[model samples]
Target: MTAAERIARDFTLLLPPGWARIPLDGRVPLRVKNLVTERVADVPVEQRETLRAALTRELTAVLESAARQGGLDVLLSVAPVAGQPVPASGLVTHLAGQGNGDALDSLVGTLAAGSGTSSVREIGVVEVAAGPAVRRLTTRRERVDGQGDLPGGVLTVTQVDYFVPLPGTRDLLVLTFTTPIEQLAPPLVQLFDVMGGSLRWVTR
Candidate 1:
């Protein structure tokens, strides 16, 4: 049997409580509305509708942006991780190739050398439940001026990307974790590390 035939085409991830997978379908608006409603359920009834409307609009925009960036699924977290309340999010994407670890390493090297506002904080191979994977941490300073409802300022976003190579294939499944909460980066990164370690390949 060929390598592709011997390997699984699917994988699974374990997300903690309060982390939700946003569907990238035509019904995204509806899903956002439902999520907004649930999130504002504790607000005063008199101001619930207004708050819901505002949150729905904002969240819809975020999800739409994720889709435009080739994200398969956008995961949003609003609860505590590692015993601290830290709001963060993630995106899953795939890259198809025809090489092996050497190819992945070359790709990583290219990424590390790319010029941008973002800087690579760390890059190395880490063993997870699925096997060896390349982990890269980066931070970018984004200007929030004229960017939707965000206030005018430089927003520092911390991101961690895991490039997991499929067994017997050059293709990779990438998990990207990001957060604008720079003050809580250490714990948030730890949470991302745990999440990445939980990834498991599913067999046919």
Candidate 2:
């Protein structure tokens, strides 16, 4: 099997009850899941389909852009919890920056310390489905001054990075969960943790 296909099979998002999965067409299908009521009476299927279509449009652009840059492939998902105002989105990316562990670490450190970021704290080592991974926590605030659409003017963004080694390959499987801090709740956080922890490499 090809490397991208092999990496794709390594893990899956284990959606809790009331969640439904939607697959978006890309070079590969992007698997997406969202909190949905079992009964059609709760939220009409048409309404949900409309939302899914919109999300697919946005994700397609993001993934396609990433593809233009070498060594990055992604699987994207969207999950909207019951009470939360903003839904959670995820990206599991395979990036081959510098093509080595040490180079990847240095690149992450550089981004963490870069100008726009508020702070990038070292998370050190952690384990994922594939093997040991280096983690980092980064903080940034969105500004409305010259940006696209934001009436409120600012939103705090938090991103947790996991650099997982793809055995016998120079590429790194990057598991990243980025969400606005204020909108993040325990349940959503747990979802990210569970998905990241379940990552494991599959060999043919």
Candidate 3:
């Protein structure tokens, strides 16, 4: 390829997964698709390469920065009861004697007679304490498939899982890193150990 060809081709080289070439509204307008879940967002022509490059550089820098300040992201999802905690069924019952009593009373009486009234009124109320707080780790290595932190030829991500405190709370944390599978060695272990040591009373 000649110089001009090389320059033109460089327009789309080394883009991360999930990013596709897109037409833009301005001069030299092109964008990469976000490779993981969503397609790479539209770039403002001037920022595509900058954003991608920054994603590469900033991911490592951010992780290192976070390590210095302490804490990484943890995702802990909890599925609560499917319905609303407070049902409005009894609200109508309690206010049955109020202004619009006749219709509400009639509806309640009919429903009660049917023996299929909202049992939600009787379900035990258990207010779960505020759970953990996990933040999204802004990763510089934006592409899922490319760029890893592997060093010394030993991959051990599956062999590891970790939890951290939510900054200033006792609530536990869970999160995943954008770092490469092979790269989670000392720092990963260290973070896990530190959190584990601090929470030995709560966690076994």
Candidate 4:
């Protein structure tokens, strides 16, 4: 059997309460509508619709952007996790093996070195529930165009990435947690670390 076939065809991870898993599919709009409805339910009846529509549009845009970036799934937290208000998000993407058998460390090193203007905060092998994986943290400034009353400027985005290699293959499942809320980065990253520790491989 091929290495990929011998291992699991997919994997799973644990997300804290209030986290929503959004798959890239035809039902994205429907799913976003549901999420917006639930989140804006507490708003005044007259304002709820307006709020819902705005949120739905913004979220749909984010999900579509992630899909175009090769993300397999997007995990978004609209509520607080563990009593702290964290609106962080995550993206799951896959990196297929080159078949030339490059080592995981070498692959990670190459990725870290290609971060362009982003600063690599940390990179090392870390032990988690799944096994040893490469953990990389980075921060970069991203420009945001002004919209409505919001002024356009650059925002610092912090990201924590876990590169878990599938057993018997050089393929990697990448879990990337990101947040633009720089003030709350510490707690957000701590939550992300716990979530990363909960990753598991599912055998076919």
Candidate 5:
């Protein structure tokens, strides 16, 4: 399999019960479980889709904390905006900046520091748009780290990944952020059991 596909497989293991991945055009489906009802639901997109969740605010703060301690890649969930039919533009700044790895790194840092590392798996059914869709984000923070080969423009970077059931319903939202972020899938699988058997999202 291609590296990206492998990454996708690795990441899918992170989902919790009731959660699932629904394949929509231009979307990488990611499914999650319902917290209370034990119902399963499908998240429309993957990649930065978790950012599309409702917990963006809370997650930003949590990841911010975790990054301070070590590297982080979070898998969290948030409720979706019902009937809202996710706007072509996400509520959160999905495409906030478009530049080099430093710029991306900075954005990640800021998100991590502000939100702190979060383990909130409450949200579900979020719409996400990565690469160029987020046109109106203001750089909350910026730090140039010229240490690595690709010195990142660190922003206390933190990624808030959230999942929510469809129709603004309350369900299990899973959030986990730490480095080796590539390991997001397995944790998510565990998350499924934690919440209860839910949806098994379809993979591409």
Candidate 6:
């Protein structure tokens, strides 16, 4: 199989058997719009569009940055449950070259040093189907800024980043999962690990 085909299959097989997939580029905008509408319900209807435009711009920028790092992205959504533990989901990014662990470590460290509200909790190498991967966990506590309604509300976020270098090709795969601290249970974290370990890059 060609590298592209191999990578496509790798992403498809990454998801657990029955999960549903969502196109981030297509759904993100609509989701963001809904969020803005719900959060700013008290605002004058006429001005809602203006507010949405601003919020969407900011959100799109952030997502775009991440998308660049992962040339291709895989996003998923699980079936609904009466009370789901946030329906665990993640983003996967693949690039046609290996990633540098030392550089990533330094970059993460630098980010932590500059941000008073964020910290790097752990950094190390772990084995995944692709090969040895750099794993880093980080924690950040920030206020929900633009949610005009939830003014000053603090939110703690936990994020795990995995940098996997394909066994044979100079390619790399980046996987990331972020969840609110309140919803990041041990079980969910374990599920993330298991899903990540199953990433196989077939080059045949």
Highest TM-score model number:
4
Per-residue CA lDDT of model 6 for 97-199, tens digit only, reads: 4455445555445444654556778776777775567777777886776565656677777777777765545555667777665455466567677777776
Q: What TM-score does prediction 6 earn?
A: 0.58
Order of models, best lDDT first: 4, 1, 6, 2, 5, 3
**Candidate 1, residues 83-154: lDDT per residue as tens digits?**
664568888876667336656577667668872668899987788898878889999998776657755877
lDDT of 2 at 96: 53
| CA lDDT of every candidate | 0.78, 0.56, 0.27, 0.81, 0.30, 0.60
Model 3 C-alpha lDDT per residue in residues 1-204, reported as the tens digit of each score: 233222221211121222122222132112112321121245566766776676545333433443343332211111112431111000000011111212333433443344332121211111112222122212122223334664344322221222223222323333232234435434643443333233212211
| lDDT tens digits by residue: candidate 2, 51-164 | 666655665565556555432334333343464334455555666533354455565555556636466645566666666767766667786464456355677777766777
Q: What C-alpha lDDT does candidate 6 achieve relative to the native structure? A: 0.60
Q: Whole-model lDDT, candidate 5?
A: 0.30
lDDT of 6 at 194: 78
Error of 3 at 186 (Å): 38
TM-score of 4: 0.84
Candidate 4, residue 78: Cα displacement in angstroms equals 1.9
Return whichever of 5 and 6 wins on lDDT. Answer: 6
What clash count goes with each model?
0, 2, 15, 0, 97, 1
TM-score of each: 0.81, 0.63, 0.20, 0.84, 0.20, 0.58
Candidate 3 root-mean-square deviation in Å: 24.3
Worst 10 residues of 1 by lDDT: 1-10
